[model samples]
Target: MTCMRCGREADPPPRHRIGFPAPVKERILQSICAECWKEWEGVEVKVINEYRLSFLDPQHREMLQKACFDFLKLPEQA
Candidate 1:
């Protein structure tokens, strides 16, 4: 698989299914390599903490999803 973020050929990462819909999960599996996904994990934490996000709120969840898409460089509707 080719990593969309880094443009390198690599083994796909383990499934990261939390919060994402099925199509988005498939896109991630196909496009994102493990290294970039790992990097996103670190950024995800920082984003949640920096924004004081709580998963209890629907809007917060949406914001986190947006952040994930942006960080992974995935298309908005892909």
Candidate 2:
């Protein structure tokens, strides 16, 4: 599979989580490749720390999800 962001050829992605709201999941399964995803993990960590986010909060989760979309350059949901 080719990475949509960097255009690098890579192996097929592993299975993802069960529930991510369809558009968010599609952004992950389609545009962001594994390598980029790994990098995004690090970025996510930083954002989580800097923003002092807690995963238990739905608002925080949404914030992180939006950050992921921005980092991946995926278009925001309409």
lDDT of 2 by residue, 57-76 (tens): 89998998888878877777
Error of model 1, residue 22, in angstroms: 2.0
Task: Name the lDDT value of residue 53 in candidate 2.
Answer: 94
- Model 2 off-target regions past 4 Å? 16-23
Q: Tens digits of per-residue lDDT for model 1 on 1-78?
A: 889899999988787534566777788888989899889888989999999999898899889888999999898774
Residue 30 local lDDT, model 1 = 88
Scored by TM-score, the top model is 1
TM-score, one value per model:
0.86, 0.79
Instruction: Please estimate how well model 1 matches the true structure, expressed as its whole-model Cα lDDT.
Output: 0.85
Pairs of colliding residues, candidate 1: none
Candidate 2 at residue 62, lDDT? 93
- How far in Å is the alpha carbon of 74 misplaced in model 2? 0.7
